[model samples]
Target: MKKNIYYFDNSATTWPKPECVLNNLKYFLNEIGGSPGRSGHRMSIAASRLIEETRETVGKFFNYDDTSRIIFTKNITESLNICIFSLLKAGDHVITTNSEHNSVMRPLRFLEKKGLKITIVKCNRFGELDIHDIKNSIVKNTKMVILTHASNVIGTILPIEEIANLTFKKNIPFVIDCAQTAGSVPIGINLGKYKNCIIAFTGHKAMLGPTGTGGLCIGKDVSLKPLVFGGTGSKSDEDTQPNFLPDSLESGTMNVLGLAALKASVNYLLKMGVDKIREHEKNLITRFIEEASKIKRIELYGTKEAEKQASLISFNLKNLSPSAAGLILDKKYSIMCRIGLHCNPNAHKVIGTFPNGTIRFSFSYFNNLKQIDYAIEKIKEISRIE
Candidate 1:
């Protein structure tokens, strides 16, 4: 008999995507094959229409009125890089949290070398940020404030709405990396109230879409220079890049097939409702925490409360390295999860798990209580041997 693989790495990328997404991926490839916004042919027009429909769907999902403000990228990393590279200039100060993923860290580090001042506001060991510390870090020349919506390593959900409000009042552009919280948590997209905010999202993770589907929702007041310049299907009469919302930023052949998959996935979420998804994941987290807390020698990280976190947990055995434990879970128990720094060494350092990271079990809505029980039992068994 084939071993049943129990996947618990939804924070990295969700597995077993919605049937609609898979069907559309095939439909786009087989029936509606064409490059979006590249030509005026029938196939191209169909592709363009599909892209626009997806944009509208995304805009509605985020509660943003302007559909054109939604710009697609390969992933949240690319979306963040575009915002970081376009907004900051020489001698500008930017504020961020220490718990940020490398997607936010690497680009800021690259900019810091070129006369950009960076302030890393410290989060608690639980990965919770203090809003006052963020406010205190802001200065006269603060160009932007970029932060992650949730810690991908420890699953702590940061207070991004409060941060966005603060940055809006300060006239500083707030860029939120929502790779971990987009489809799992509620992202306030009140563009009228918070005009200087951008929410960057990846579709593959909680959105239940394929890879290469991600984008940013830009506010009206924020202006960003194009990171890439090429054909935008519009304003072809001039060689200059079009000075518009999405056309100015998106300048290449788009991933129409992937977007079709994303559209279907987002539609599924919309129909099912994000609130329901959040409730289900919270129940799973609650169960995992309750069960794992009973086992001796199992050390868990972050705020031990499920309400204060996303749907994930990070922990370590008393004597086992995260790598070794991950191997045991995979080979011996047929369990799958993420290990190591989770691309955020800074998060590990903050959580006091640096050098050797913790094993992360990130759950999705599809995961059931039985899986959590089995995982806890296996973890208990591992803890006993080690």
Candidate 2:
């Protein structure tokens, strides 16, 4: 409705968190401004309680059997590092997809140079990875399999359950980077079913929380060595990190404020129901894709249909570069989107738009059909330009 500003970049980071989120952050800053699990005071205890509540809410979201398995990290990137660098050793083989963000790919590549073997399965131009491809990639020495839950640029949702089943049978520790799909899509992963799994989630994206809020859900089979060893309020006497679910992984002072905000966001989502949120986002996708399809010169990426795609879309103009499209959207159309590689060069490569990449328009429950309408109108104009 505003003159020149519509935020359509929820896939990268969601905007306008719920009122509860803001209130919780404000409360944390005002009242519970203490280092959680560190200081032995009422303020610290309150902070710790907020953090635990967030973990419990997130654990239920993923159907985790134990809330304690949820370990806080700065973001999914940090969670990936904790899972990757902690679990994999010198001669281990790891399976992944081409549709991964550099967060996962970068660490894996670094380990690859350190003599860890890596097998990269290529998704099709639409960013669809095959379960058979993953099954074939499993080697005897394979220790872990890491892949992104959804393609950040293209919004292609992977069949984690199918792949998870295969890996579960093979007894491989599966680490999933749920940067785009967590809290946005249905994650009915029964942690009991998968013997080995670690799902890394960020609160800044579809979770609709503030930045610097994220964590990793350590599954049954993945016994990760601690990434950073430090003092936990629970085990202050021990020189080493505590041999527990969260206290082992979490080090230093925790992000109490961010966690408090995330707790409110997660509580709001749970109350609203994930199914309803998915429905809202899916509706936006359907309308947006239909309108974009009618526009000439609009080169859509990922799965062709809206139903096949997640709540995001990536595309480019016939004669415009991604950055140019982004600029036009910002200055003229008032739409905010991500351009260029979208932090996943391999995802861009999979879509045959490597190097330059495409403009990514991802949405969440906050976005409405009317906003999608405005976006469609502006996109039609931009796509037609020479």
Candidate 3:
């Protein structure tokens, strides 16, 4: 194994987080160790303030004003599960794309077995979704439109704005999985208008926060039942769940330490500006794609254009299984990346890489052209391995 590691797996979780995140985590652990919304002590009040401030920062980050609707979860998977299991009933119909992660698919499939109808609109091999496809798929009974803002497998960005507009006109709930784009790309929904939209985001990825931190920015028009019922500290006198925005969804002791770090991370993003980070990652993707295209055995996937996708690229080296190549990349070159179907077999099938998936390089703002060049060089060397 090589000593120096070049991380290209931001889509999974971002490593080398900003210094502020770590600093805040330490600060919370050392000083403010109390459960938010659970007590009246000063420590508890401080913890609650951290969470509310983090909620406010997230609201400004997403350009949404309603901070009370921001509900935190352990990860985007939980946020998505809350949306899927709470909003849709047995007879309800939901629309999603074939490019969704298991977070969306698994819950929907679970409901499908119980009589819920699901429509998976197929995207092009490049993972590009046509907004018209979603429009055409909408039915009279369609209760929700749930899909990813970007494909976790291919890094292809979907037309969420158009889809949100369409769903808004139809008066249907629109759920967006922002796991891959939350910190890297600007979330394009104007909540004032598209009040039916729900954006699920994770903190560990591009947000540069620690794991066990993620949340859902709920729209005004959308109301979901509590997925986990417990003590929200509010309406604790009643045993039943609270019929409110965040309290309705958030039930338990909030992750105050994680939220403390998340607040710092989001503050960092707001300070650095997401557009600048996006531009840097786009440059990495553009350079990687350009170099990888020149390699003899490399078969690039997705749109092969930086502008068309997120900050990641998927490709396969001819005569090399993704698993084998990934192992070699890890052991020989210290290049960390994700391979195989990336937990989304539907996306792999769409791109004709099912069973044998492509090696995915998910870049981050911290990654640069030098790392991209090195990875491409390593891939070139790996391609020659007979």
- Give the per-residue Cα lDDT of candidate 3 at 381: 95
Tell me, what's the RMSD of every candidate? 1.4, 1.6, 1.4
* Model 2: pairs clashing at backbone N, Cα or C within 3 Å: none
Between prediction 2 and prediction 3, the one with superior lDDT is: 3
Candidate 1: TM-score? 0.98
Error of 3 at 112 (Å): 0.6
Give the lDDT of residue 12 in candidate 2: 84
The local lDDT score (0 to 100) that residue 190 gets in candidate 2 is 76
Task: Give per-residue CA lDDT, model 2, range 196-271, as digits (tens).
Answer: 8778899898889989989888887878878888777776766866898778887788888888888889888888
For 118-178, candidate 3 gives per-residue lDDT tens digits of: 9999999989888888999999999999999899988899889999899999999999999
Candidate 3 runs further than 4 Å off: 1-3
